[model samples]
Every structure is written in structure tokens, then in C-alpha cells.
Target chain A: MLKSRIIPCLDVNEGRVVKGVKFQNLRDAGDPVELSFHYQDQGADELVLLDVTATRQERIAMLETIERVRQRLSIPLTVGGGIGSIEDAGRLLNAGADKVSINSAAVRNPDLIAAMSARFGAQCTVVAIDAKKQGEIFQVLTRSGTTAEAIDAVAWAARAESLGAGEILLTSFDRDGTRSGYDLPMLSAVTDACSLPVIASGGADSVAHMVEAFQHGAHAVLAASIFHDANMTVGEVKQQLTDAGIQVRNEW
Target chain B: MIQIINTGVANIRSLQAAFDRLGCTWNLTVSPEDIATASHVVLPGVGAFAAAAEAIDQLGLRTAIIDRINHRESATLCICLGMQLLCESSEESQSAKGLGIIPMAITRFGDGVKIPQLGWNEVRPLDNGPYDAGEAYFANSYRLETAPDGWGAAETDYGGTFISSIWRGRTLACQFHPELSGTWGESVLTQWIEGITC
Candidate 1:
């Protein structure tokens, strides 16, 4: 009974959550730890904190944020962004991140995926591919979707799985921030191309969008703005998903 | 105090946090002496099976772990890859050997289901097990297909039924990570910590 996971992705810049954050219940909407507690209280299956910090000095802040959040939050926490090496991944894991997502670094040196998987275990190594529709095919985009690597997203996902990635975080660049819905064709292409479990990201603004993502072969659904917009809680999303006939972990 | 054997890989910090939440005093150590004599020893591991098994052997904790698991005083608990180590061998690493305490083998899950089965799954108690039926989070590709003799088990289904947990005397080992499995997992830890397993 592997239930579909509902994850709330938070952007942690300089250790504080930033961008599109409008939590009604949170007094300090920027604090990563507090925001994590809010998500946990809402019965989120897991939390993904992307370290959107630009400077190296801000790295320590994200680590501190992870440690603080781990001290209280019991659900699994995944940290991504700015992970350029095995050391970066190790630091986040030591700081209490259950998994580390790599994008540009993985694209630059595909071997890094194998290295991370070897040292930490494949279960903790996630290869995130931000895909943008380029004519008939989806092109892999990296560096915050500023660059296209000329690699087909589906093929890259297969390569990542062969290189020992435990999971794939496939985000649609075209649909991100638009909230129109997930790029279903691109998501299904990646999931169908690889055997690893896929987490569908980007353009998830409604419960139906999430349901469609699951139906399109997503093992988990990751949303940021939908949850941060203060429109709904993770519990309500899970409840609706359950009502829609999707299996989810029941809250105790 | 529970002394956790440092496998040198697993997410020990988060495991420590779980114990702290339970109000239990614990410490981390790779010392065989500590594991051999501690009131309760925890073997927590994440990563490759061969690597972990080799680490235990190289650290000289193999014999101590076996001795502890056989102890009548509720001595040991193993988690995830820790559970695989109790078995004699695993398909994950054909050349490497497990601790060989349990008479069983580990193999990869069959196709038709996602490999390295991740996310939350139900753990159904067996033989009047300590905890009630509840779901627990899992992140494993290899699993024990059948229950070993002289042990109690709780199984989970994905591609097929696999033993998710096994307990004998005062010792327990789980394929699913109890530390990350939410409340049902916490209750599992509480039951084991208090030596309340049936």
C-alpha cells in the first residue's frame, strides 16, 4: 500500500522562506522552521526546502534551518538547490535532510549522481529535471530554468535512473508559477521513461491538478504556491485526494 | 540509556531527534564494547547493504551485535538496512555477507511495482505483535519475502507481501524506517523502548 505523498515545497533563501509566502496562520511567514511546523501540523507527508540562497555564506543558514526544523518536525525533509558536490549533499544530510535534490550539478557531471548514490544510498539521491516544451520534445532546463542543456527530458530521466538515482523530481518550466496545471505529457514521458518513482512538480494549484498528476503517473505531488498562498492546508488536500479515490497516508 | 551503533552512514541525527522527542536518553558510538554492554543497542543504517555489513565487521561490532540480539534483557533494535544486516545475505551485494543472526535472505522487489518502493505503506501486525495495525513510511528495494522461524513479524504489501518487521525476545528490526514513519512509528519505538512487545 504505497500511498501517494503530498509534499509542500518551500523556498529557503538565506535560511528564511521567501517568495509568494502568505501563510495566514504563521506569525513569521519567512522563518523556515516555523513554516515547516505549520506544514507538519497540516499533515504534510513530507517537506522540500529549496535553498534558493545565492551566496556561499548563506549555506550555513540553510543548514541551521534544516537542523532546527529537524529537531521538531517528524516528517521527512528534502533539501535542494545549490548542491554542487558530494560534500554539499553530505552537509545537508548531516544537517538532517532525508534527501538531496540535484539539478545543474547532475547535468554537468552525471557521475555525481552515481557518487551521491554510492556514498549516501540511492534512496537519498534525487535527480531534478526542470523541463520546458521545445516544439515536439521537452528540453531539460537547469540553473533555475535559465539554461537549456539540449538534452531530452525523457532520455535524461532514463539516464539518471541508470546512474542510480532513486527518484526523479520532474518540474515543468512552462507551467511553473502559472498554476494552469502540470505539463501532463512531459510528466508522463519522464515517468514512463524511467523505473524510479517520480515526484510531479510545478503548476499544481488545485486538487484536480494533483489528482491529474497522480493519474499521469506521479508517485508524489509537490506544490509551493498552492500551499503557501493560504488557500488550503495539506490535510485538506489529502482529504480531497482521498475523496477523489487516491490513496494517501492517513493522519493519526 | 540506548546506545546507537554508528554505522557511519544512516541519518543518525534525525534518529537522535526521534529519541529526544520520546524523552529518552541516548548516545552514538561505533565501539563494540559499548554495543556489547549497553542496556539497549540500536543498529541504524542507510546506504548499501554490503558497505554497512562490511563496516560492522571491520568495526568488530558483528559478534557484539549478535550477542546483544540474543540477550534476554531486551538488548537490540535494528532499522532499515540494519534489518537486512541481521539476515545471512542480500541480493544487493552478492559477495558481501550479513551478520547471519537470522536465517533468511534479502532480495529485490519484483517488477510491476516501482523499484526501491518509497513513501508510506501499511504494517500489519502478526502473532499478537506489540503495535496495532498502522501504516509506516518505507524506502527500500530489497525485502524479506517470508518470516523466519522463532520470530514475530509485521508484513507490508507492495508488489507482494514482504516482512516489514521481525521481533524475537526483546530485539526488533524493521525494513521500514520507524524514525521517519510518523506517529505509528513513534509508537513502535515506544513499545520497543519500554520492552512491551508481545
Candidate 2:
């Protein structure tokens, strides 16, 4: 069976891996490459390197950091933050990123999804939608989940899939860092709206949450704090998922 | 001397970077002019059938690729979607026509499996296959249902049945992403490149 994936997200700023409590007051985690290699060794299925620094100087630094990480890790690495054009996607992919994720840029230029899909192949292109619960709908939020937009997460996910995005990385701002478990309702909405694989991010507290994410329609689960704080290991998470009747990769 | 025919699929950059890491000279090309002079060819893609087939047709790379693969018996390695394109057709999209070099048909994994078979998978080699069974990366919705035409070198199990890999001949392919499949995947590329150069 197609095994469910467990991915570790590394937040990078100025080429250094940084961890923040509740996405604020960032603290240096370590070198991006070393941290990524550590996760890979710890049995992470994939690594998502989000270059949180959006400045031009930071982008150059981000690219250099990406190059370094690419040389070190052998598994899939996805980089987001400040990705705007197909050319940018091309450059990142050339630099060794297995996938290029677009959150804010994808919202601004929806057509960029199709263009990147055509140029880089859909599987290598991911549309990450950060959302905050707004009554009955999960409103898409940009700028690292600070600004909420009127866009419906489900609707945008459908549009993204139609535009040829291989996968949709859905993060819930409401539950992010709360460790209350993933927002099953919102994830169900996105999964019900699109046929593409969905990666559930935010609000993963324990191994149970990881297992529940897959049960609630997530093809893969993305977690940070829990993994970063050494609460649980990727191997343990996979083991838990396996115990819960979810197909997971055993040999890391 | 090798040209990775860009038929507008994803994962080209990874292949290019892998080739770079291996110190193997290659170019990403879809033009006939480039294909004509290439000693070896690589067809790399990552997407559904409709888009991939459409890209090949739109770029008019079908003929150039066919001419080179058929005439020179040029060594070709098709990764992931590129491997699917080597088949006769895929169920992902009805309109998607494959290169038909390998006599297989693409089909979707049943309800037991997820849509996109993402993550690392193990490859089991048959006796006298191209490479021994090892871990290979995969991310795809549909897979080639039947075996390859002349060579059925390797296979992998997703949920039920086994999928083809290292389906060697002048035309070779694997549904897994060798470029991202780690050291073993790179070794497969080295073997393929060496086979072609030989």
C-alpha cells in the first residue's frame, strides 16, 4: 500500500535553522544542513525547509543554505517562503530541492501553480495553504498565518488541484503550536474537495495525533515542535501509525 | 553527450543535479537539434498522464525522442512519470498516450492504497535483473500495470501487485525517483550511464 509519510519541517532564517515557541521569538536550532541530516537519520520520511527570511539578501542566503542541505540529505526536501515565479521554482529545484512549496505567492498568482506544474512537473510543486478557522469556513491566511484572507481553504485547494498542484500542504493556524491535535474538520474539507494528496501540518501533539491525521484523510502528516522538543521520534511516530493500522515505512 | 528530453514533467532539476553530483555531463533538451546529437537520452517527468503526454506533443519531442531511441538504440532512462510514458497508455487520463516502447498499460492503485504513492519503497530484483533490490523513492498516483516489453528487470509492491523497475533494454525505466532515491538510486543511475557509455 502507499505508505503515509511523516515529514519534519525546518524553519530557516538567514541560513540557520530556527525554532520558535508558538511561531514567535525564534531561537537558533542549529545549522540547517546538520539539523536536516539529523532528522534524516532519525527516520524522517522528508524534510521541509521553509526559508522564513523573505528579503533579497536572505534569499541568496537561503539558496546557499539549500545547496548545503541538498548536498547533505538524500531524502526529499521542500523549500517555501518567497517563491514567486516558475524561474524561481526552477532555480530551487536545480539547487536540489525535491519540491518547491508556495503559500503567499500561490494565493497572489494562482496561475503560477499551473505554470510551475507544467515546467517542473506537478509532483514537485506543492501549494501550501495556511488557514485559520473562521466560523464555518477555514479562511486562508498568508504571511506565515498572521493575515487571514477571505479565501476558502477547501475551494482554494480544489482550484490548486485543478491547476495541477501535485499535493496540498494544509496547515491550521488555529491549532498550530497548540498541540491540540490536527484540525480534522478542516482537513476533511480539503480532502473532500480535492483528489490530490494532502499533507496535514500544525497541532501535532503526540503519536496519536499523527495517526489521527492519516485517519482524518491526510496522506502525510507534518510536525515541528513535538519533534524539535524531542517529545517523540519519527521512528516512534511511524511505529505508532503502524500500530494503528496505517501503512508506514518501517526501514528508515 | 546525454540529453534529458524535457517533456515538461517535474523532477528534471533533480535528475540534472544528480548528474552533476555524479560528474556526468548532460543537458535538458526537448528540441530535435539537441536530440539529434545526443549520444544517450533520458526521459524524466513527474505528473499525471494527460499533462505529460500533452507536454511531449506540445514540445514536438515525440518524434525526436522516438527517432533517437529507435535508431541509435540510445540508452534511455525514464524516471517516475517518464517511466509511465514508456508504456502504451495510462488510466490517469484517457487521452494520455505513452511512447509504447514498453508493452505495458498504466493503471491506478486500488482503494486500498492512497492516490499518490508517496515516500520510500523497496525494489525487489528478479533473477538476472538490472540491479538488486534496494530502497527507491516514489510519488505517483498511477502505475504501469503490465510488465515491460523485452526486459522485466525489477519490481516493487505498493499494495497488491508488483510494479516494473529496471525494465532494461535500449529503453529503461523505473517508477521510483532514482535522483531522490538516495545512494542506491544514484548507483542505478551510474549503472545506467555506464551501460549506455559502454
Question: Against the correct fold, how does model 2 do in TM-score?
Answer: 0.82
Using Cα atoms, each model's DockQ against the true complex is 0.84, 0.41
Error of 1 at A150 (Å): 0.9
Chain B TM-score, one value per candidate, order as shown: 0.97, 0.89
List the RMSD of every prediction in angstroms: 1.0, 4.5
**TM-score result, candidate 1:** 0.98
| lDDT (10s digit) by residue, model 2, range B1-198 | 778877655656567767877888887787887876666788887766778888888988787766766663667777887877877788877767887766668888778664567677778776465666787778777876655545656767777766757554555678888887767778888888777431
lDDT string for model 2 (A1-252, tens) is 456888999899888778852322224347777777777777787899988886888888888888888876767899888888888888788787888999998898899999987766677889999998888889999988777788999999999988988889999999998999999999998998888889999999998888778888998899999877777767877777788898776655
Best candidate per TM-score, number? 1
Root mean square deviation (Cα) for candidate 1: 1.0
Best by DockQ: 1
For model 2, the superposed segments whose C-alpha errors exceed 4 Å read A20-29, B1-11, B19-41, B47-75, B87-100, B103-117, B121-128, B153-162, B190-198
